[model samples]
Target: MTTLFYRKIYAMKTADSTEFYVVRHGQTAANLQARIQGQQDTLLDETGELQVNCLAEFLKDAKFDIVYVSDLKRTRATAAAIMQYHPDTPVFFTPELREWHLGALEGRSFAELNAAYPLLMQQIRQSSFDAAPPEGESMLQFQERINRFMEKIASEHPNQKILLVTHGGVLQRIFNLAVGVVGSGNLRPLCHNASLSVFQRRNAQWQLAVWNNTSFMHLTSANDTITL
Candidate 1:
């Protein structure tokens, strides 16, 4: 196990700053297998379980005002660890925050995907955020859904510290939204298991305080790629 010293995301919360502690869930069985989990629910694997302990220890004292997670086992497991410390914190799930449905590609690996469906794979490789896999929703559809979710949260829980436990795919969308990132085929950091990203909105502008943070991963494998 690796060890990392973490600083509080928001050392001190202010009345005007709305802070979000957005986290991608820990490692999963699918991740180890190099398969796409998509919206298919899977619980945390053995390593993921230990990763949760490190995550919880890092966040136990943030005292988030509320917690939100996608209605998926991996994320739920991570959120559960935090709840053990913040026993009184309210935690809930929403389907919209789940992973981007990978459709027919679910369970398939990138290596086979490249060989089996070269054209489709090309589209994916091109960063076709608006393109969808067979039987999947397009990136446009996914982004719109995420936008609505963000709006609802900001409106409902203004000026509060919030914890969002969700998939790496959704986290990508949230990160893109946060950075006004547009277009395809751009370089973006990989989201890691049990990683955290911090965001704040001021004057209607979103600012990324952190990104793809695996500071806590010092407790677990640093190479587990929670791919989007």
Candidate 2:
């Protein structure tokens, strides 16, 4: 969609509200193979490059005051593509915006992991609020991290437009937080690669303006929520 469309739909921003144009990073080989990426720093695959190119074109005319990107290869690449339009826009690379650190399970395919760690896989699939991969952050810890980062940014930049390039898990956490979902056992729509989601913070409250918008990509691909 065009930037004009975005402005029309989100025209409620006041002098104190903050707008967030959040984007999940493009695809990777792990995404196609159903592997857990976590903090692996995987590069984008061929299709991922094309997806981000389309996304960059779609957002080329959007105005952004600042940009926040996850300190990972996939997210960085995606952010780079989009920031080409706003060369002078200040960008911050932070690990706090990175994917849930799956630790030892970072490189394993879903089927392989399920075969070896059935109970853990079950917990992950069920979205057990406390379940975590070996040596990884639990669902609670991840949620806290995301909440802290979001609060910090919103407090720092009022009445400004911000662009956030992160991961699917982070997007999912943001959605959960916006909807008052404390724990797991709740179903969420899949966050496709290179999808765009928008949130607005007004009077210290965050509201979802859009969710899982992939119209720019022309096609949708695997998301981190995929499972066998």
Candidate 2 residues 58-151, lDDT tens each? 7887888999999999999999989888899999999999999888888988999989989888877766776777889987788889999999
In terms of lDDT, the best-performing candidate is 2
Candidate 1 segments whose C-alpha is farther than 4 A from its true place: 1-8, 219-228
Per-prediction TM-score:
0.88, 0.89
Question: Global lDDT for candidate 2?
Answer: 0.82
Taking all chains together, the TM-score of candidate 1 against the true structure is 0.88
lDDT of each: 0.77, 0.82
Model 1 lDDT tens row, 1-228? 221233456574666767888888888888988887889889898778777777887777787888889988899989988789998889889998998887998888888988888877776655566467889887767777887888678778888998999987787788777888767643345777887888876666766777776666555452373232
